[model samples]
Each structure stands twice: as structure tokens, then as C-alpha cells.
Target: MTLRADAVGHAFDGEPVFSNVSLAVDPGEVVAVIGPSGAGKTTLLRFLALFERPDEGTVSFDGTDVWDAPESDRLGLRRRVGIVFQEAGLFDADVARNVEYGLRVRRPWSERLGDELAGLLGRNGTNGAVREALDLVGLADDADRSAASLSGGEAQRVSFARAVAYEPDVLLLDEPTSDLDPRNTAVIEDAVDRACDRGIGAVLATHDMNQARRVADRVAVLLDGGVIEVGPAERVFGSPDDERARKFVAGELVY
Candidate 1:
């Protein structure tokens, strides 16, 4: 599935966050939204993930304008997208349990019912997706640890593992690796690659130009309350058509 925003605009109270920003992420593609602080990257991701409604324009899933559709349709669209915030908003549970909760919520009701029945029938009921997800995030050994006990990087990795366990159609990651060490950063990047390989589109919002360069297939530059440029990663970083984008990527522009 694809997630695209067309002329989308949003604001907080009386102040505008962004306006007329258009961007798209195709299946198996990784799109990066890069800008300085207060550029509304997180707000845009929230709208695309179906958590926040846009004030204008549309955020579409595949060919369907989810916001224009019914509330039920909006919920369905939300089920197909996973979001990781700048903060790791994990539940008060152990690592394995947290990941399992993420997976269980996204499963079909029939499958979940079957698992419940299997438990009553004394069956294992699971195929180890949670363990595999933890392993992917390099937190296999910390499965029994509480979320409160994890370090900053470890908590972030656990959050990533939780969101990725169900393999949603789109991943909305907001500064996912901002506080991570290099090793932990690679773990998250590799997990993103694995998900993209399975035809899951990903939107990574970050101010880190190098991180965008390392992970993006396409790049969208948000500035002055709008997307100033959108193009292939090479073109956006190497030779952008927009002057603001050019200076922003070159580190010569100050916010």
C-alpha cells in the first residue's frame, strides 16, 4: 500500500505548523523528511498515520482519501500504519510482553479468537514473531527486562521492535534514532530495511542529513511551513531545484 499527502495543512491553536505539503511513499520505498527543529515534521507524520486530522487537503491510503472516508475506514487505515514517536511511549510491561501486545492488537479478530481457543486446548498458539522481532532489534536478551530499566537506546530499540513486530503497511518513524548509539542505530536501520524488503513503505522524519542520506530512497525537505523540495535522494541532497533545500542540505543555512 502507498501513503500520500496532497496539499495537506495543519496548525496548533492559532499558529500554523505547515501548509500545502505534498509527499508520497510507495511500497518498499523509504522516504525521508528532513528539516530543522519546529519544521512540523512530527505533525505531518501524525496526520499521515491517521492519529491527527488535517485542517486542509488530504492524506490518502492507496487511492482512498482516509480523512474523507468514514470513521471506520479511518480506523482501518490506522491499523495498516505503525508510528514511533520521538519519545518511546512504551507500556509498563516487560519487553517481550510489550512486543506481543503490539502484535496482538493488529491481528485479525478471528486469528486472536483462535489463539484464545488454542490456549484453552493447551497448544503453544504462537509462531514466535515476538521473539523474532526482539532479535531483530538486538534486544533478545532483554526480553524479560522491564521498560523502566532499559537505557535510552535500549528503550528506543524496544519501541521499534514493538511497532515492527506486526509488519504494518507503512512505518511512520519520528526521529527514531536521535539518541541512539551507532550500533543501536544500525539495528533500527536494518530493521527498517527488512520491513521495506517486504513491501512496507517507511517515512523517516529526522533533522540528521547523514541519516537521511543513509536510509532514504526519496527525500522531502520541509521548510517555512511547506515542503520546498521533493525528489530522489541523490538529487535532493546533491542538486536540489529549490534554493532553500540546497542551502539546508549543505549545512550553510541557519534556522
Candidate 2:
């Protein structure tokens, strides 16, 4: 499977964010997008998640143009793409339930109704998927804890768990571990690797150049409203064709 952006551009309230941007990911590959703040990394992921339409270009899935598809088809495609925003937007519920939210939403309405009926009969419990997701983020022992009681790092891990619970074909993460400690950051990175091992493609947007160099199979450098360079991670970091990308990778460029 493939999720791709072709010369895509977006504008916010008549202000252009980026233009002529192109990127793509296939199953089992991790593509990292790195840039300064407000360089449109999140906006680009939004387009990939089908939350926003680009003002000038195309976002496609498996070679089919996403926006041109019917709403039903688009919704189906959207469900197949999972996203973790920069913020941890957890619900006011138990940790397991927060992680289970994505799985529940992706379920068929009829299946959800059956679950509701089961809950009425006192048969409700978190599923194996929820437990597995929690385990992936080292939250298996915290399943029963209230989300509100968790620390910021724990909350972020829960958010990551929730996004990956459904095993979406495409994963989009925006600075997923920006606030976590090293241990927690390692956990998140390992989980990402496992997801890719399962043949799930991912797009990671991060500011940590070292993390990008470590985890990304390929890298895209976004600068001055567009992608200045993108290629295999080594080439992009070691010997970028664009002077801006070279400086950015060398720690000489600052936002």
C-alpha cells in the first residue's frame, strides 16, 4: 500500500503554508519530515490524514486520488490512516479505554451496537487489541488507571497507543515524543519500529535531527515553505544537494 502527496500545497485563511510539496510512504518504510516550527509538517500530515484538502495538489492512497473519491470511500480510506498530533488528546476515561477509543471508532456500527448490548448485559471489557497496544507503550500495568491521573509523558504514550491500536495501514505522528524522557522516547521509537515491522508505513514529523537520522529510512527537509531536500537518510544528512538542507542537518540553520 502507498500514501503519497503530489505537488500538494495548502493555505490557511488566504496565507500560503507550503507549495509544490511531494512525499510518499510504502508499507514497511518510515519517512521522516524535519523542519523548523511552522514549516507545515503538521499541515502536510493533516492532508495525508484526509482532514484537510490541499489548495493545489493531490493526496493519493494506493494510486487513487483521495479527494476525488466519494465521501464513503474517503471515510473508509481515512479510517485506514491513523494520526497522533503534537498534543496528547486523551479522553477523560481509564487508560485502556483511551487506547481502545480508536479501535472502537473504526469498528462497524453494527459491531459497536453489539458491544453496547454486551455492556448492558455486564459483558463489557477492553479487548485484546487494547491490551496489546497498552503493552506496546509499557502501559499494560496501567490499564485501569484514570487517564486524568497520568503524567504528561504517560498521557503522550497513551495517545500513541490509541493511534496504533487499530493497526492502520498508514501512521502519521507529529512530534510524538517531543516531551518524553529518554526511556519513554526509546519506548515510542521501538513501538514505531515494530509497527513498520508489521508492514505498516509511517510518516514521522520531528524536530530532533538525531532521532530522524536514527529512525528514518528516508528524510524530507522542509524549509522556507517547501521541501528543499528529500532522499535516503544518509544522503540527506551527510551530503544534501540543497545548501539549506546541508545547513539544517549540520545544526547551522535555525528557525
Candidate 3:
């Protein structure tokens, strides 16, 4: 799916966070939003996810204006968009349940599909898709484990699996690697690449330029509440045209 933000702007209590911000995520593309802390990266992602309304612009998904769509259509549209938060956001349930959470939310009887679901659950009785999703994220072996028992890395993997299990057209990730070690970070990054391979467009909001360089096809640098520069990842990081972009790349504080 394509996510297009046309001059989107939002604020809280009259304090402007950003204005006239435009962004787009095309099929099979991963666009990274890099900025300093408190630069409105999360806010932008929230707007894209329809969790927040833009006070001064529009957010469109797959050629449909989300803000203008009917309630039923909006609900359907939301089902096709997935958001991976900074934290794993898993419940107290087991690993399998966590991975299949989104599917259960969308289609309560999804387990009635076939043996694949049963296999995921370690038996042919039922509840197998949960296990399959966990397996997809390398957490299959932990299907019976509790969410609270997982390490930060493992929990994040479960979160990724859950988001993808629903097969959303667009994935909005906010600081996806913030709480993981390098190894786990790499695991999640690879999953993200695989998501794009499956024709899911992604918008990742991150504070790490190195991670952006490693995963992003294009990068948009947000400074002082607006997009200062956007282009190929290499050019944005290696040869920025704007001074703000250059300073951000050089490790100086832009805020």
C-alpha cells in the first residue's frame, strides 16, 4: 500500500510540533524518518497510523483519503495498516497468543483455517497460526512461554511477528530497535526487509542514522518539526545538501 501525507501538520495545546510535512511510502520501499529527540518523529507516525488527526493536512492510504473515508471503510483501512511500537506491547499471554493477536482482532475465527494453525500450537487440536507467526519471527520454540518471560529482544520479535501476521499493506514502525542489543536489532531489521519483500511498504521512525543507512531505501531528515531534506539514503547521509541535514549527519545537536 502507498501512504501519502500531504502537508500534514499537528500540534498539542497550541504548541506546533510540525507543519506542512509531506511524506510518501511506495510499494516495497522502506522510508526512514531520522531526527533528534523530540523532533516529532513519533507524532508523525501516530498521524500516519490514524491514531491522531492532522489539524492541517491529509493522510491518504492506497489512494483513499483516510480522514474522509466512511467509518466502515476506515476500519477496513486500519486493518491493512500495522504499527510496531517502540515497546513490544505484548500482553501477559503466551508467545503464540502475542504473535496471533492482530489476526484474532481482525478475524476471531482465523484459527479455523487448517493444520498450519494446529502445528503452530504444537498439536492438531487448534490455535496453530499463533505458533506459525512466532516461528516466522524465530520465536516458534517459545510458543508456550509467557510474554513476561521474554527478554527485550524476544518480545520485540514477537511484536514484529504479530504485526506481519495480519499481512498489512503498510507498516509504521516507531523506534523499532530502541530497546534491543545489536544482534536482536539485526534480527528485527531483517524481518523488516522481508516485510518489504512481501510487498508491504514501511515507514520507520528512528533516531539512529546508522540503522537508517543500513535499511532505508530513502531517508527523510526531520528538523525543528519539518522535513529538512529527503532523498536516497546514501545521499542524505553521505552528501546532504542542507546545512541542517549535514549537521544532523555529523552528530551535532540540531535541536
TM-score of 3: 0.91
Candidate 2 global lDDT:
0.89
Each candidate's lDDT (Cα)? Answer: 0.87, 0.89, 0.85
The deviation in Å at residue 212 for candidate 2 is 0.4
Tens digit per residue, CA lDDT, model 3, 95-154: 777776687675444445555664564433325666655666777788889999989999
lDDT of 1 at 168: 87
Per-residue CA lDDT of model 2 for 1-255, tens digit only, reads 899999999888998899999999999999999999999999999899999899999999989999999998898899989888878999999998888788778754345457566466331444677888888888999989999999888888899899888889999999998988998889889889998999999999999999998899999999999999999999999999999999998989767
List, in order, the clash count of every candidate structure: 0, 0, 2
Scored against the true structure, residue 78 in model 1 reaches a CA lDDT of: 89
Task: Rank candidates by lDDT, best first.
Answer: 2, 1, 3
* Model 3 vs truth, CA RMSD: 3.4
- Checking candidate 3 for backbone clashes, the offending pairs are 117-128, 117-129
Evaluated with lDDT, which candidate comes out highest?
2
Decide which is better by lDDT, 2 or 3: 2
Which residue segments of model 1 deviate by more than 4 Å? Answer: 108-127
